[model samples]
Target: MNDLFAPRIAADPSGWNPHLAAVLADLATTDAVIAAQLSKWAHGWGAPFSLGSVPLSAVYATHVAPWNPPEVTLMTAKTILWIATVDDWAERDDAAPRGLDHLQEVAEGKAPDPHSALAGALADIRDTVLGAASSRRRGSLWVKATTALLAGMKFEHVASAQIRDGGPPPALPLYLHHAGQTIGVPLTMATLWASAPQPACDSSLARLQPPLESASQAIRMANDLQSYERERRTGDLNAIALGASPAYLRTQIADQVRHCLEQLRPLLTHPCPDAQALHYCLHFVLRLHQAGDAGHLHEREQQQQEH
Candidate 1:
């Protein structure tokens, strides 16, 4: 697993951070149960597209393992797989609105039968995560985040349709707001907070808001940078596709990540375990993108095909 963090110095990637590399080295190892459960659930959920396309192990090792134990990692993996499955479906067809409706109903506490496999997977993830939450407040926050993610997805679908119909892309601020939620950073954070060890220092979500937003923005920009080519190829919506040069986009991404790290620095020095955990989560995501390994499910497929 050490190879996972081996410096790609040959690239001299503008995003590389030594501290982030150290974090990756420390947390790259995953429990066998996580791997096994990921495989089992991927198959059972009828999400062969995820197995064939997305870099699931890489995503888990980088994003989920650092903040969670084996059981939580497994649960997080299931949720991620479900999200990826839904994203793939959304990209391929016009079913996203219906899917989002089903998810919204589930997130609102209704127990209606899911209308599709994607919806069913979301319902299952909601139940599993709520059952594992350390407190009712955290569970409630998770539901709200899920609903927010659905809304974001709906927004993306609308934006994509507009572009597909020959309209110009949305302005940068509007795109980032929608993209942040569509990227599911808030939902992922809620899950991490929910399953985190009991009584974490400075556990109030309010306290972590600024850093979360900063980190999420960084992740969103990094994703745009890393996946720009693939998005262009697929006629997909990306922040970079909003008419910016690659050089300009890279600069914005670097600035965004720097801001996130600055926000995290004070929290890390504050002796709060929850704040520290949130810091770790944000840093992990930042470094994953810095490594230039962060991309959408379809982007990974494109890489596979090219190779």
Candidate 2:
């Protein structure tokens, strides 16, 4: 947190903040991995995301964990796309099977229902994360996060269905609280902690809980600010779609992000690898919004494959 207040260090590779630029140069290499895996994940997992759309490697992987081994990077990418693909599936077509009904159960090592690519992806991701976790604590955190994420999605899903059927949306306060989980930050962060084995803060899921809450809410609202129109048309749950003014939403985002950073400050003071990774995410997301690339925050917009 003090670093957020301090002047930028001269050593930052990019002129952006330290976390955003620390591994700035290496994101391209990870971009290659995201590309190659997307193709495989496309066919292999029946991924709802397109294989042709290239990912901004920074938003997906490099920004979170450039220091991760390629194998862990693969797992991280899988977890990300899996969550995004399901969210997309839910938004576009509710008639089809979501395959996410038992997401937490599957993530806990149950066999994915046979022939369901979405479930299979979760199973694979879980196996990889468990294998990478050096301690039971990390694995437990991943499961807890996954469970909470599923619960959040379930809450929003019901709200979407209600609105689609002509009912009123969830109350603003409840909607805002659950909205961030639908963006998938908690699950991804926990996965990173387990897979990258962010050694500095693995002792307890409690270590990251406060900042994680702030980051997730900030990210969810960031998307809501920009995607309100599309979401309103689709009858999906969004703060802006529910009549939150852009100005008000922006205030909420700033408050959440500021609170997140302050909570992360104490952890960052030590050599916590998890803090470092999450710090990068917090700043990169805000910068993305500032640059209008925050649409990438939604994940459905990334449609590229590097030649």
Every candidate's lDDT: 0.67, 0.72
lDDT of 2 by residue, 237-286 (tens): 88877778888877878788889888888887878878877888777665
- Residue 245 displacement in candidate 2 (angstroms): 1.9
Would you estimate the TM-scores of all the predictions? Answer: 0.80, 0.83
RMSD of each: 5.6, 5.2
lDDT of 2 at 113: 79
Scored by lDDT, model 1 comes in at 0.67
lDDT of 1 by residue, 15-80 (tens): 799997777565554534466667776677674335643345435533643555676766666666
Per-residue error (Å), model 2, residue 101: 1.6
